[model samples]
Target: MAASTKNVSVGTVETRGIEPVPDSERHGHAGQMFWTWFAANISILGLPLGATLVAFRGLNIWQAALVAIVGSFGSFALVGALSLAGKKGGAPALTLSRAVFGQRGNAGPTLVTWLSRVGWETITTTTAAYALLALLGVAFDVRQNSFLTVLCLLVFIACTLLISGLGHATIMWINKWATVLFGVLNLIVMGFLVATVDWSKVLEAPAGPSSGVIAGIGFIAAGTGIGWANAGADYARYLPRTIPGRRLVTASAFGAGIPLVLLISLGSLLTAGDPSLATSSDPVSAINAMLPSWMAIPYLIAAFGGLLMSNHLSTYSAGLTMITLGLRVPRAWAVVIDIVLMFLGGIYFMLIADDFYGPFSTFLTLLAVPISAWIGVIAVDMLRGRDYDPDALMDTSRTSRYWYTGGFRLPAVLAWVAAIVSGLLFTTAGTGADDVWFSGPLADTWPGVNGLGWAVSIGVGAAVYAVFGGRGPITTPASSPALEESVR
Candidate 1:
């Protein structure tokens, strides 16, 4: 068998082993790329779906709107800020870790990101299965069970394999079209609500001030934006610096954050009529009841399309992260492996995730600290005014800063460890009917809101890394590679 020859670069750093894609090989220009990002990132429909079901049942439209607005704006600002930090710190994310944890240190965060992909893949598969079950229930009055779950799993795995097998370019192409279809469906639902809904009902206040409204907002924001945070660079890495990547910060932010809130709001309004249905686990069920039977077919098709789009993205990002970790596998092969794992993991969840809310919530809680730490370090690196030479950032050569100290960076390592510990505390703290440790009013009601885990993780990780990790000098190259520096 012939060896695959695709070059593997670490983060954005430049080096010899890696080769830049020819213009023909590159995906598209900036506008095209932006839309691709918009579509790819929006696959997070499950995030808002989960949030609406679990967090704010009685919230009036005003409150729902407010929550959506805050969540969207916060995510946009944070993701943009973190991306800017990565730009400043010279691939401060996946690559910069080399300076702290060693070349092997990169493995720690990569593993975290990879695990996050798996979590998302699992969650998405479950949600897709759940949504299909809801449709079945609506049609035939059948109940959800492990059998339906397994059937959905088979469908999801099949779709993932089919789409991903076509390659990255094919995925990008599908994303553009899916986004258009999704946009039309979004317009349809919102249009219906505006046309039919009683504004007075939507404007009324909820039953009472929800216990974890603020904290609930936090978890919702985290779930919605976490995937974007981990893979922001997957798109940005290809951005031409002349285009001013900062604007991308804004575009990327609004592209994702605004639409998410609107979707949640739409779900809220659509479910407002049947108060009991508002809290239903399946988002489709909650909203589908609002529309006429004629609308169901198109809406279901759109919803299923949206589900597949997002699921494909999770698998795609998982493939990229796996490759970054030096998996030495073709992307096609990596995606296949990812689909297999997602199918198997999803089956496990179907049988024993216990409560939909419980395991899903626990999964996010476990992830909160480490992911926060990773984002925090990158943000701090930007704040410190670290210089990012694009060529150097993508280089895989041994002489670059990434390869200095035998490919390990201590500051990144320490920061990661601290973040993990903080996350553990935040997840495990507090008990039922008692303040565990640092349990606040929010934690008393909302299971996931107790410890302010996200804040602690970001603050501690950033503070520790900024104060201690900033002193290292950029290593200069010695043995010269006889080639012109390739630009992205």
Candidate 2:
């Protein structure tokens, strides 16, 4: 029989690795997804995203709100849809990818997904550390120093490791309770911030061009959900198969969407009054400056808590992805390795780097291409009714069913590569026109200029894969009683 949730209580390390959860062990309602995604997105990062809409994209309050709604909700709905794969296969997203791409072929997407997770976690850790530093400064008049910066990074990483190392049960539990506690705190802070908004300026701001709205939506979608598309299954894998898939999708969309819409709109409103929030190198301090002195402590605390919630989930998924990459270690140990890397990354971001958003924007743009391509492939695979073979997923040898053509699925790999190349042709990343990091040949095209490269990547990946990839007969898992018995 499969293990029970009772055996995996809070604070207990989840012993399961990348293998599919046996059906008997699967237990959870789709409603839990609401809290899971809600907690993941409750971070204050949405503010800057919204601010960028107004300050950079040149959208007014109403247009920015529309962009936030469509961007945040629509993208996460796709995440919810892809999560159905996890419910069916009961494995991590990348683990299930072994079925779509052969074992060796899966390595590329796995590596890219892992890098995206680590990159996001590092950003979360750095932001959370900044929140702590700001909190200390507000409460104790303490000043930032090299020692304190490193210490704060360690402290934030330690907190992340604690929950993520505990794995699924703890993450689910924390997601629910932490979301409630921090959600209320954030609302209170938002209430204060809202009071200070210059209504006159906000109301009078002219609407930006319709093109800005399109680009703003693309930017928000890429930043908010594209980064998370690969990890959807990591959390959903434990849910029972019988749960309504649409309910899971709705829960995830609304859970993430509601807060994001509010935060992003609020960001736009705030930026309409003071554009500095969009341009500030230190967003934490910039937002703090807007609040009254006493509210600073709770506001920063809420920020820290929110970032922690997001970091733990990212770290948890990164750990699973690491193991999927053939790391011969326990999941918890994998989390430790992830934390160490995040700590190093946080140190570099805080102490070494002079610019934050520039590198972060570049990271987001460059990685979104491959990740979206993976999403495109996986989404199409799901449509074809692909199912995972438990035994084959773990077998890396030539004898495995998924070891096609020397462990590569030509159509899927080719489509992914081709889509990435095509998408990059219209992609560009940098802080400003003078500091351009990379720009593709077709970057002058409307889609590239409008920041729709990630969108184009997904469409190209899906179109190419759909045309070339599904010709092979769908490989269903064997119905052997012995195989079923072994898994149980």
Candidate 3:
């Protein structure tokens, strides 16, 4: 039965869920990380992020490019580091997080992570649907009515559900091959777009203040790699323990970093010429308008394919997270539930929402705080040489090693909550002062004004956990020969 369950292969549904992957099933090299991350990030979403830096943050093209490089590369490096926990423990990230946050206590971060994944999946789905709509419009002269809109969304969601429901092996396979196919198509389209850029206007744009650059970095990081930080281990959990931690980190960073920098720089340049792209409601159609008539079809195709790649990965992680949150269903069923929600979200965004960038930017800003806090706690635990006891991770009762103090790890929970509060105190999310959703008391402070709330959250979470985490009885690895020998 164990062997049958471990039979994960390309084109087959991966049966594993939040459970730790047994040693016998572990197979892969660090290099795969590059393709996984690269495929996830090749979507045109990064373009608007760059545009926002120039349009809203008042950054020049050069400054926006610099922010992209630093923010994307640095954040994914942290993702790679967190992935080490997955490799060591041989479990999904939140599953391994049980060791750090305790069984019941883990629910808070797990819930937040699940919500983040769902939010991103919905955004990706909506964006891809728009791409498909644009493609149909350009290719066959189909107009986007309500019926066509729903149809496009269903098509994208169905594709995501199929890939994500197949789980890990299938996602990895598609990541490699689809990345190659779409990467070439996107580059061709990008070449055409680049040729059309207004160079004089791009060069004449004045540089913004240093403060804008700082905010741009924060926005880029939050939008790009920070969103994926928690899900790093969901993909990496299948790798063998022998892989060096640094190698994994390097692969993830560069895999995601390479395309992001180029796309962001292009976005900045394009926005420098026409700032309207930054505030466009439908980025897919907006970008398509700039492409030559001949290139529009392929450009939209690339956009659709790229967003599909990203959505599937996010959906896959969201499924695992849902299971981790105690959802009583098979992994595939959880994916189905998530897809249903995503479908609804797509409908709302396409039919009801007044604006796209406003809600998206606010979502990123608000969610970045709790996610960063979780990262801080997990990073500290990983650095402390924590090893997950697989059996204990599954055992949710008082007998479990992870059931720290009435099923709550107070230190970690306290740290996470405190960090979230502190971070929110600095977070101000809205289009402007009049339209603010919620602004913290410290919203006028430099960190608040500059959008460094996520950074502040991480620091506070780590600092608080470091001080109080040792107060309780320290968890030790279960004394099992299989586990012992594996570590050695």
TM-score of every model? 0.78, 0.96, 0.97
Give the Cα lDDT of each candidate: 0.59, 0.90, 0.89
What is the C-alpha local distance difference test score of candidate 2? Answer: 0.90
Quote the RMSD, in angstroms, for model 3: 2.2
Candidate 1 regions with alpha-carbon error over 4 angstroms? 1-27, 32-34, 40-59, 81-100, 133-149, 193-201, 206-213, 270-278, 351-354, 383-407, 426-451, 471-488
Winner by lDDT: 2
| Comparing 1 and 2 on TM-score, the stronger one | 2
lDDT of 1 by residue, 57-103 (tens): 44566566666767665775566555543332323245444444455
Model 2 steric clash pairs:
none
**Candidate 3 — which residues are off by over 4 angstroms?**
1-4, 471-488
How much is 114 displaced in model 2, in angstroms?
0.9
In what order do the candidates fall by TM-score, top score first?
A: 3, 2, 1
Error of 3 at 45 (Å): 0.5
